[model samples]
Target: MYIIQDKRFYVCLVVACAAVFAAIILIPNWNRLERGHGASPRVLTIGPDFTRKSLAGHLVLVEGVAPHEGIEDIVSGRGTHREIALSGNLALGYRTDETWLKVEMERADFRRRNLFLWMQPSVLDHVRVYLVERHGLDAPRITEIGQIGDNDPDYLWNGVGSYLILEYKEPVSQYYDLYFNIGSTSSILLSGHIGTVEQFNNRMYASDLTVGFYISFLMTVSFIFVVLFFRSFSKNALYFALFSFMYAVNIMIPARMYELLPVAVDMNVMDIVNVQSLILLHIAGALFFRQYFELWITNEGLNSLSLWLCAMLLAMAIGAGLGGWQAIMPIELGVVAIALWLYFFEYVRQFLSGRKLSRAGLLGTGLYSVEVSTYHLILIGAVAPDGPSLSIIYLANALFILLFTLGLIEEAAVQERRNRLSLNLRLARRAEQTAVRLAREMTRELEEAKVAAEKALETERRAQAEQLRFVDVISHQLLTPVAVIKSSVASLRRSVGEAGGDDAMRLQRIETAVRRLRETIDVSLVRSRISSVGGRARKRKVVLVTELQKIVERSCRLFPSRDVTLEFDNLDLSARANIDVEMLGIAIGNLIDNALKFSDREEPVAVTVSRDGDELSIAVRDRGIGVPVDEIPKVKERYYRGSNAASYFGTGLGLDIVNQVALAHGGRLEVENAPVGGLVARLAIVGEFDPG
Candidate 1:
C-alpha cells in the first residue's frame, strides 16, 4: 500500500504542474500587449443618456485631460483659439466624426485651439470625474448636453446617467478648473490640485493598502502567539512586538482610509497617522531589541529603558504635531533606527553569552532573520529595483513563519515533558536524602539530650547535698549560743531571790542578755517564716497589685519609722495577674524593707505599683544614696550587696533573697537610679496587675 501511494504522489504532482502550464498558455495577452490603450481612445459619439436615479448604483467613468494644448498655444504666441484649433492635432487618427466632449477656453482668445479635451460621454457610464483647470477653479459650464436614444451605441450612456459641463478655459493662466456631472449629480471646482486621475484610480484603489493592514495585523497576532507559546521568553519582547506592529499599522491608516473611502481625505488626518506610526515604529524597535537582548546594565535598567522609550515617543508625537508629516517621518525613522541598532548590538552580545539556543530560539531567530531580509528586499524594490514582486517574497516569508512557529510549539511541549520527568526524579532523590538525614539527626539529638539531662540531675543532687550540710553546720553552731543563754537565765533566776544588792545587779544584767538572745531567736524565726513562704512555689493567680500593696503597708510599719516614709502609689484598677499572693507579697516586702534600710529618714521612700499590658511592675524607690552604677547589676545576685550598702547594719542577703523570691514567682528585680536622686528597685512581674 505504501509503495503504491508513493508512486501515486509523483503521478499527481506531474498532473498538477501540467494543468497549471496549460492554463497559463491558454490565457490571452491583451493586457500584456497594451492593446486596450489605443482602441480609438473609445470616443463618445453623442451624449450619455440615463436618469440620475437609474445611475445611483452603477459605476461611472470620467477621463482626465491634461491642459497641454493651452500651454503649447501660449509658448507659440497663439491666442486661446489657436490652442482650441490645435485640438485637430490632438485627435489621434481615427475615422470618426463623433467628437468626444472637448474643453475650450472662454477667458483667453479662442484664436487657434481648445486647450482642454473634455471627458468622453461614455466616461459617465463607469467613472466619476473631477476637472483639472490650469489656474483658478470654477464650476463646470454647459456646452452641449443631451441624452442618447435607445439602441444607439455611438451616443448612449451605457451603464447609468450622464451630464456635461464646459467651464471657462484660460490659456497660459493658473486659473481654470474642471467639473464632474452624472445625470443630475455634479461637483464644481475643488480646492486642491488634481495630479493624475488615472494614477489615482489605479493605485489608490489598489489592494496594497489592505494588504499592508493585514500584514501588520498578522504580525501583531503572531507576536502575541509567540509570547504565549514561549513562556520562558521575556514579556518585554512580546510588548515590543505588539507596539511595533501597532505602530506600523498606525502608519498605514491614513493611506488605508483614503484608499477605502476617498471622500474623507484631508491633510491633517494624513499627517497624524503617518507621523505617529513612524514614532511608534522606532520606539517599538528599541524596546523590543533591548528586552530581547536582556541588556541590563544598571540595577533599574528595565525601568530606565521604559521611561526613555516613553519620553521619546511623547517627544516625537509633539514634534509631529508641530512640524507636520514631511519633517517628522525622516527624523523619527532615523532616530528610531539608530537607537534600535545600538540596543540590538548590546542584546546580541548578551544573548550570545548566556542563552542556550533552543529549538524555539532557532525558530524565532530564523523567522526574525527572514523578516529582516525581506524588509531589506522591500527597500531595494522601493529604491534600486522597480519590478521585484513584493507579494511573492511576503508570501514565502509568511509560510516559513507559520511552519517554524508550529514546530517550535511542538519542540517546547517535548522539552516541558522532559523537564517534568527530571523534576520529579530530583524531588524523589531529595525526599529520600531529607528523610535519612532528618532521622539520623533526630536520633543523635535525642541521645545527646538524654545524656545532658542525666548530668543536670546529678549536678542538682550534689547542690542539694551541699545545702543540707550547710544547714546542719548552721544548726550545730546555733546550739552553743542557745545553751549559754539558757544557763545564764537560770543563774539570774536563782540569784533574784537569795542575793544581796550586788548579786541582784548581776542577775538583772544576766536577765537582760538572755532576753536579747531570745529576741534574736524570734527574729531568726521570722526570717525563716518569710523564707518558707517565699520558697513555696504555687501556680500564680490574679491580685498581684493588692498583695504588693499589703506587703508595702506592713513592711513600712515594721521598719524604722523615724526618717523613712513608705508611700504606696495607687495601681491601675483594670490590671490583673496570675501569681501566688503570698509569694508575691513576700517578694514585695523584702524589696520595701531593703529600700527603707538604705534610704535616708528625711525623704520618704515611694512604693509604686503599675501595670503595662500583660505585665505588672512594683517599684520601691528610696530617696537615699543610690546604688553605685557599677554595682546595680550585681545587687540581684544571691548574697551579693552593693559596696556602699555592705557597711550598713542589715545583712547583705536581703536583696539576694528578694531576687530568688521574685524569680520563683515568675518575676524579676531591676535596680536603677530613680529620677529623683535615689535608688528605684523595680520588680517586673510578667502578669496582669491592678495598680489602682
Candidate 2:
C-alpha cells in the first residue's frame, strides 16, 4: 500500500519508464540510419529502348558550369570546361554555380529513343539539355534539343515533373554526345534520372506507392483530428488537422502528382502549388505546437515571436502565389532563424522550470524544427540538404498529435482529481457546519434514552424482589399451615389407634389432603422462582446416585400410599453431575408426583436417574392414562391442566416448573407416551454429567 515510499520499487519504476522513453526515441533513429545506406546503382543494360523499370541511379554529373553557361558552350568546349561527377554526394552541399549532368550512353540503339531526365526537387526554375556531335572541329554540330529552364532541354518537355527532359531525334549503334545545363533560383538540389518512357511509368508507380502511403496516413490522422476538433472544439485539434492536410498536399506536390493526373496546369501554377503548400505547412505545424504546448502561458515572448513567424510565413506564402517569392525568400531566412532560436529558448526554459514537454511534443517540435532548418538552409545555400522533407514533416505531425493525445489524458486526470477534491471540500464544510448542532441534538436524545433505560431496569428489579417476597411469604404462611394440618390429622389417627373404622378413614383422608396441599405449595413456590427473570439457580457437583437416593427417600416419607422407586443405574461408580441440586430435586419431585398421581394404584412409578450425553435425565414413567397428544404442548403452560387430567388434581405449574428448571440448567424437559402404555416425563439437566 505504501508503494510510493518504497525505495526499491520507485527505483525500478524509474528505470522502466526511462527504458520505455529510450526505446521510443532510439529505435526509429536506428531504422533511419539503416535506411540511409542506399543500394548501389545497377548498370543500364543495352537491351530494350524502354525497359519498363526505373532508371537506377548510375549518375554522371557534369559539374563546374558558369552561371551564364549554355549547353552549346559546353558542347563547343568554348568556355569553362566540364568534369564528370557521380551522383553520390547526396547532400549537394554549398552549390555556388550553375551545374549540368552529362550522362554518356555509349552502346547501340540511339534510334528514335527518348531518354528523359527526371529531377525530384520540384522547385527547380531552369533546366536545359543538348544533343551534339563529338568534334568535327567547327562550331561542333550543335542542335538544341528543345529547351526549358537554364537547365535546358534539347530534352523534350515530357510535360511531366519539374525536371530536365531532352527528346532527341538522332540515332546510331555507337557512342554519342549529350550536354546539359541546369540552373535553378529556387532550392536547386537536383538528382538526375535518365530513363525511357516505360521506365518512367515504373518510377511513377514506385513513387506513387511510397507517397501514397504517406498521404493515406496523413489523411487518416487528419480525419481523426477533424472528428476530435468537432467533438471537443479544441484549438489544438483544429490546428493539427490543418497541419496534416497542408503537409499531405506538400508531399503530393513533390511526387509530381499534377503530371500523373491529366490536368493541364502551367509550370507557374505547379511552382505556386509547390511553394505555397510547404509554407502553409510550416505555419500550420508551428501554430499547432504553440497551442499544444500553451506557448501563450508558458512564454509570452516566444508566443509573440511565433505570431511574427506565422505572419511573415503567411506573407511569404502569399508572395509565392504572386510573383514576389524571390523577394520574400531572404525574409524567410530571418524568420526561420528567429523562430528556431526562440523555440529552443522556450523549450529549454520550460524544462528548467520543471515543465518538460511530453515525448511526442518534444519529438514533433524538434523534428519539424530540424526539417524547417534543413530546407531553408538548403534554400539559402548553407548546409547541404539530405533526405526528403515529406518524411520529416509527416513524422513530426504524427508525433505532435500523439503528444496532444497524451497531454489531454494527463489533463483529464488532473481535472478529475480537482473535481473530487472540490466535492470533498464541500462535504467537509457541510459536516463542519452541522457538527455542533447535531452533537447538541444527539446529546439531548441520548440523555433522554439513558433516563428511560434506568427506569426500565429499576422496574424489572422491583418486580423480581416482589416475586421473591411472594415466594418467602408462601413458604412460611401457606406450607406451615399445611404441615400443621397434616400433623393434627396424624395425631387424631394415633388417638383412634390403628384399625379400620369410620374415624380412622376420615383422619386418613385429612392427612392425605394435607400432604397434597403441602406438595402443591412447595411446587407453586419453586415454579414462581423458576419463572422469575432474576431466578438464580446455584449449581454444583451433584452426584447422580446420591441425589436420586435422597429424592426416593423423601418421596417415600411424603407419600406413604404409593410405592416410589429411584432406579439409579450406579451408586458406587464415579457418576457425577453439575446442577442446581435444589431446583433439580424439585423438578424431579414434580415429575414423580405426576407419575404417582396419574397411576391407577400403588403400581410403582419407575423414577430412573441416569447420564444422557452432557445432561442428567430423571425419567418418571407412569402406567396411568397417558396425556392426550393434542393437549401435550399446552401442558407445560403455568396452571393449564391437560384434558386427560380432568379426573386428576394438578396445579399444572408442576410440569411448567420442571420445564423452566431444565431450561435454566441449559437442558430440556421431554414428555412422551412410553412404549408400554404410560406418560413419561423426563427432566434433562445439563451439567458435567460423567458416568464412569
Candidate 3:
C-alpha cells in the first residue's frame, strides 16, 4: 500500500510561527517612527508634597532624574532657573527656564486650583511625603515627614492628583540652617489617580526602555518558543530576526533621546527624536506583522494606506524639525490614532480566527495591546495643556509594561508544559502498539502448539486400532489350525486299528502338520499379545543381522527337507534401533514359513540381511512361482488369497502379519519378482543412523 504524507500541517505550523514574530518585532519598530503613535509613553512623578507653606506655594522644577530612578533637586520657580537647574532638561526637551514654568503651570492648573488644590487626603489615601535636606559645614541632614490632610474632598470622576512641595534656604554661612513646611498632595478633582514612587518610575521608563524591552523580549522569546515547540516551523527564524532588528532600532531611538536630549537639545524638543523614532518603528512593525501573520493586505490598499500615513508623519517630522513641536502635536496624534486603530482591529480579528496560538503569541499580543492603549492616553495627556494627564499616562505605562512582561513569562512556562505532554503521548502510544503485537504473537504460537498436539493424538488412536485388528486375525489363525490338527491325530489312531498301513501313514503325516502348526500358533499368539501392550518394542533393541539369522535357522528346523540357504556377501548389517525382539522374530518367522511352503524341496530358499545408507534391508528370496502381478499388490491384505495359491494348505494372513510388524517398527515390506524366477520379499527398516 502507498501512503501520502500531507504538507498542510507544516504550512499551518509555519503560519503560526510567523504570527509570534509579527508581535515581537514588527509592532515595536512600527511604533518608533509614528510620532508617539506605536506603543504609548509613560511619565512618572515621585515625591511631591503640596501644602500652604510647602511645595504647594512654590513653583518647582526637576531635571536629571535617572532613567527609572534617582534623585534631582526641585526648584521653586516658573521655569528652568539656573539656580534650581538640574544640569539636564525635561522629557520634552524645552530648556528655557520661563517656557518650562509656563508648560508646567498650564498643565498642572496651579493658577486655577490654589496651592491646596491636590491636598486631598481621602482620594489620595496611599500618598505619603518625606523630606531630607542637607545643612552646611559638616553637611548635617534634616528630615521632615508629612501625611495627606484629613479634610480633603472626594469625587467619582476625579479619582486622585499629585502635588509635591519642599522648602529650603540658600547657605549664608557654613553653620546656617533654613527650613519651611512642604506639601505634596493628590486632589480629588479632574484627572485620575497618582501612583506610588516606584510605580511612577516604572511608567517613565516604560515609554523609553521598559515597554521597548518588554516587547523585544516577548518577540525574541516567542520566536524561540515556536522554534522549539514546533521544530518543523523553524524556517521562519529569519522573519523574526528581521522584525527584532527593527524593534531594536526603534527602542534605541527613544533611549538615546531620553539620555541625550537633557544634555544636548532644548527642553521643549526633548521628545522629538523619540517620538519620531517611535513613528518610524511603528510603520515598519505594522508592515512586518502583516506579512508575518499573512494578513489580508492587498498591494493597492497597503500602498494607499501607507502613503497617507507617511504623509502625515512626514509633516509632523518637518514641524518638529522646524521647532514647531506644539503645532504638529495635534496632527501627529490624529494620524497616529487612525493608523493604530487599523492595526488593532486587524490583530484582534486574526486572534479571534481559529489560529494556532503559542504562549509567546498570546503574551506578545496582550502586551502590544496594552502598550497601544497607554500610548493613546499618554498622547492625549502630553498634548493637553491644563490637565495632569501626562503624569497619569506615565503611571499607567509602568503598570501596563510590567503586566505584559509577567504575561510573557507565564506563556513560556505554559509552552514548556504542553511540549512535555505531547512527548509523553507519543511514547505512550508506541508502548501500547508494542504490547498489542507481543500479545498477538503469543496467541498464534499457542494455537499452533494445540493443533500439533491434536494431530499426534489422532496418530496414536489409529495405531491402537490397527494393533487390535491384527490380534483378532492371529486368534483365528491359531484356533483353526489347532482344531484341524487334533481331529487328524484322532483319525490316525482309529485308521491304524481298522483299515491298514496306508491309511495309518497318511493320518500320521496329517498329525505331524497339525503339531507343527500348533507350535507356530503358540509363538504367534505370544508375540501378538506382547506387541499389543507395547512391551516387546520397549524391551530391547533388535539387531537386524541376529534376528534375520534366527528366522532362517527356525525355518530350516521346521522344514529340514527344504533347501534353505543363508547367504551373506559383505552384508555387515549391525545397526541398533528401537524394536521388539519377539515381534521381529515372529514377523521373520512368518516370511520364512511362506518361502519354504511355496518352494520345491530341491529349490533353494535364500535369506540376506544388509544395510544401505541410513536403512537396513532384509530379503528372503525363494526359487518358487512368483505371485501374479495383480495379486501381488494385495498380498499384505488380511485374509486375501491369490488364485494360483488358493489350493495350498496355508492361511493367507502370513504376509499381512509380516507387514503389520514391520510397520510397528517404522519399517516397510516390498515384494518383487527376481530375475531368476522367484518372489523376493524385502523389509526396509530405518536404523538409528546419524548421517554425520
Candidate 4:
C-alpha cells in the first residue's frame, strides 16, 4: 500500500542517513596513521637497447632512509640506512615523513642507450632523483640529477607519471646508481618499473590513453544523467548524476591529473578532495538504491539510516571543498563500510519477506557490495596479495550497474500499472452517480414540458371561439345601418329623377355613398374571423379614386363640422384592384377614422389614393397629435393603444383589424408620423388585384 505520496518518509530517511554519517566521521582510521620507511637499496639488471620487462612485482624490496640523510652524504656511504623488504608490488600506507629509495641497475650495452625509471605513486607530494656512476664499487660520483614535486614551479615531465633517468658510457661509466626521496600528505604509496627508453615511452603513452578514455566516459555518463533529471524530474537520474560526477573526480585525483595541468596544485588540497569525493559517491549511490527499490517506505529504519549517511557525507564534502581539515579520510571510509553493510542488510530483509523484486535486486547488488568491499580493503592494504585485482572490481561494477538498471525499469512498470488501476476505479464511481442523476433530471423535465403544451392548446381553442362570436356580433350590428342607407339612397334617387335634372348629380352622390358604406361594413364583418377558417373577402373591380371620393363625402356628412381632404394621383392610369373593394375600402376608412378620432375638428384630415404598376395604395393623414413615439411599434397589436389615445371613446382593435384585412387581401399596412404634423397610415394592396 505504500506509495511515492508519503513525503514524510523521505524526509526522515534523509535525516537519519545524515546523522549516521556524522557519527561515522567521528572515527579516523589508516589514512591518519604513518608507516615505517625502507632503509636500503634493491639492485637490478637491465638488458641492452631499452629491452627490460615490466617491474610490476620485481621492485618489492629496496633500501630506504629517513628525510635528514642528505643524498651527498649517502653517496659517500656514511648513512646507517637499512634494507626494506616490501612484500607486494607497491609500498602502501600514509606517512608525513620523507623516505629515500636506492637502486643499482647494470646493463650489457650501457654505452649505447639511456635508461628510464618510471615510478608512479599517484599521490606523492615531492620527489628528488639523483643518478650516480659507480666505478669498480668505489666512491659514487654524481653524473646526472633532477627534482619534482606537487609544489614545483615547472612540470619536468609532459604527463602525470613520475619518471627518472640515468646514463652511462663505456669509457666514463658502465653501471649507474639511483636514489629517490619521496613524501606525501595523505599516503606514500610507491610503485615503479625500469626499462630502456623505447619500452618506457610505449607503456606511458598507453597508460595516458586508458586513463583519459575512462575519465571522459564517466563525464559523458554524468552529463547524460543530469540532462535526464531535468527533462522528467526523475529522482534516480538526479542521484546518478551526483554519483557519476564524484566517481569521475575520485579517479582523476588518483591518476595525478592535476600534474598534467599548467597550474601547480598542493598535494594536500588534492588529498582532501579525493577523500571527500569518494564519500559523496557512496552517499549518492545509497540514495539511488533506496528510491529505486521502494525501500524508503517498506524498510523505514533502513531508509532513515541511508538518509542520515547522505547528509553527513554532504557536510563533510562541503567542508573539504572549503579547505577544512582532511586527515580523517579513514573515518569517511568507515562510513562507506557501514553504508555498504546497510545496503546488504536491507536487501536481505526484503529478500526474507518473499519479495521477488527485492530478491532479484539482491543478486545484483550483492555482487556490487563485494566489489566495493574489496576496493576499500585494497586502499588500506588489508586485502591479501592473492585477492581480487583492481581490474576485477571495475568489471564487477559495470555488470552490477547494468543489472540494477534492469531492476529499476521493472519496478517503474509495476508502479505505473497500480496507479492506472486506481484512477480507473475512481472514474467508474463518478460515472455511475452521474448516470443516475441525469436519468432523474431528464424524466422530470419531460413531464413538465408535456403539461405546459396541453395548457397552451386549450387556451388557443377558447380564443378561436371568442373571435368567431365577436365577428358574428359585429356583422349583425352593421346590417341594419346598411339596409337603412340603401333604403334612403333609393328614395332620394327616385325623388331626384322625378323632380328633374337639377337634383340628378346630388342623387347619384347619395347612391355612391350608400354603396361604399355597404362595402366597408361587409368587409369588416367577414374578415374579422380567422384566415385559417377559409374566410376571404369578395373581390371586384373597384376604382381606388372613386372609393376615396365616396369615403370623403361620407366622412363630411357624418362629422358635419370637421374638414377632410381627398387627394388622388395616377387616376388616369386606371388605378383599380380586384380586391374586396369593400375590404380595401374598410382598411382605408379605418385609417381615416383613426386620424379623425385623434385630431382636432379644426385640423383637416387628408385621404390620398394612388397607384404604381399593379399595386393600389391608400394613404390617410390627420393633423392631430401623432401616435406616441414609444407606442408606434406595438400599436398594431390587438386591443393595444397609445398612451395619448387612452381617453378617446373607442376600442384599440382598428389597426389590428386593418392588419388582418390587408394580409387577407395580399397587401400590407404601414403606419408613420406625418411630416408636417399628425399620423399617417398607408394601406398598400400589392400584387395585381385588378379584376379581369
Off by over 4 Å in 3: 1-527, 539-547, 571-579, 596-603, 612-615, 623-656, 663-666, 675-677, 686-692
lDDT of 3 by residue, 193-233 (tens): 23333443443444345455545664664455345435433
Which ten contiguous residues of candidate 4 have the minimum total lDDT? 27-36
What TM-score should be assigned to candidate 3?
0.33
Candidate order by TM-score, highest to lowest? 2, 4, 3, 1
lDDT rank order = 4, 2, 3, 1
The number of the candidate with the highest TM-score is 2
Number of the predicted model whose lDDT against the real structure is largest: 4
RMSD of each: 20.6, 12.0, 21.7, 13.7
Write model 4 residue lDDT over 25-103, tens digit each, in one string: 3333233222334543345655443565444433423344545767777677667665553434454454556666656
TM-score per prediction, in order, is 0.31, 0.57, 0.33, 0.54
Error of 1 at 671 (Å): 2.8
Q: What's model 4's lDDT at 219?
A: 84
Q: Quote model 2's TM-score.
A: 0.57
What digit string (tens of lDDT, one per residue) describes model 1 on residues 541-593?
A: 56554565566667667655644333434445444666766656666766766
